[model samples]
Target: MTAPNPSTHDQAARLVEAVNEALTPATSYRDASLLPAVGPTPPVPQPGRPPMSQRATDASALMLTAGLATAPPGLIAIGLLVASGYADPLVIGMICAAPAVIAVPVLAVARLLRGAQGIGAEHHHHYNGPVSQHTVHTETKTRGLFAKTINKQ
Candidate 1:
């Protein structure tokens, strides 16, 4: 047979080297020179979404919630102004009080969401890519009406 492709030959050689290395047991665990060099793991290639820090994410959530919490009071003030054609002091006071009543729970939700990192099983989305082989995929089977009747008989 003609000589194998150069690239294929190189790959075969590398594969054999790897297999030989794997098969050979370590002879000296106590020898410092024989041990593999320790270093920081090389970063995995993250193809999308620049990483957001926990603090940054928490801050963003807090700001968003704070803005949303202000909306109800703002809308109330606007409604009062439109109805009476003036910014009455009592109505303005009520508008200010509305936010205070709801602020605590809304802020608490933002805090909870921030602290919830790594709390639950990772939820897979369509963009998360193919499921790993280790994951279980469960499906329910249903029989057609005719098939069910035939099986029963």
Candidate 2:
């Protein structure tokens, strides 16, 4: 059967919305006061790591975006490899690992690019920093899934 006529972005949004909507609240507001949040509901100890499921989803999306696993441009490499009909197993192995090898550098460079783009590496308690020193509680604080650059003098 043909796929539904949904915009790519719309389709992704709908999928996420469905999963999020399906998440039943374990506690009512009143019950929350009497019980501690447990399981996946607890705050992440390390702010730089996305939740496991989200991380996997994000990786899949990245692969799709990078064209390593989709579309006309993506098929070019596969077509080249199969067309080559190389006798050397090493040559084929290199062809298969090529995507992953390139991906690592791309991801690394993306992180480096983020640094150039002024994304800080770590959370720090400073007057100019986001959280004030007095209010900085470790358990309550978290940041994004990227590196944190904390420059404490």
Candidate 3:
């Protein structure tokens, strides 16, 4: 997919031009727009990334916030479970979600607190752009262990 060579880039650019040329006929476009009954003028299409990135960031922040707020519920559940006579719903939920509960304080004190600093900016009047960096998180599962890293060369 990486067209490093000049010849391939020229070909790709030519192909796009050809496709765009074929898509619009002067008469066809003019005829459609000539109708005075149409509503306000249509907005122009701008070239850039779609708005999905903002939405994705919002969703991630929301999920993480929800997870951080449920710190004490998990601890209480585990405590009640261990003190129960035989069986209980609280105990079962506690056992299943124990890991998540234990991680709440760490998540708040470390990651949440760190990320909060970036949320505010009096100097950033125009745009607070994304900070790009290359990183990798490796994990070992039943399938196997893997080292995932970015190679930008």
Candidate 4:
């Protein structure tokens, strides 16, 4: 077997040294002192009021569920009656109009009750200290499944 070339031996030695340098654990400090000091804890957030009252939300949910539960069967019954020539035009018209007839007065009464409860009415605030007021307005635009919110200060 021929002796290994001097240049090839030197190259192998340099490659081994490079690999050892890479594999060796670093000696530099990796303690918390190398990181930023922790600052004071942030203030807890306050809770906001819901868009609708519990009673109203419950009532609306109940109405929606009742409508969903009854509508399909009711429609099928009406269709069968009309097909069998047993349904009168006036009765059919009244049945179709029932939702509007029931909804109008209910909505009006709800609006009046909401007004009595002072919701959406402006209030006068009296501040007794040096006050700094910062107002933020947010607008949301939604199209299909995507929504984007923009904030103006």
Q: Against the true structure, whose TM-score is highest?
A: 4
Off by over 4 Å in 1: 1-50, 87-153
TM-scores of all predicted structures:
0.26, 0.24, 0.23, 0.33
Clashing pairs in 3: none
Q: How does candidate 3 fare on TM-score? A: 0.23
lDDT of 4 by residue, 1-59 (tens): 99999999999999999999999999895566564467587656568644678998899
Ten residues in sequence with the least summed lDDT for candidate 2: 132-141
In model 2, how large is the Cα lDDT of residue 12?
A: 90
> Candidate 1, residues 1-153: lDDT per residue as tens digits?
898899998999999999999999988776457655876888676986457898988888899999999989878868878788777778677867887879989999999998887747877557567765555455546677654322221
In the range 47-77, model 3's lDDT, one tens digit per residue, is 8644457889788789999998786886676
lDDT of 2 by residue, 9-105 (tens): 7989999999987796655445445564566675647876555797797987787787754567646766676678744658667877998999999
Considering TM-score, which of the candidate structures 1 and 3 is the better prediction for this target? 1
lDDT for 153 in candidate 4 is 62
lDDT of 3: 0.72
Error of 3 at 90 (Å): 13
Every candidate's lDDT: 0.78, 0.71, 0.72, 0.85
- Choose 2 or 3, whichever is better by TM-score: 2
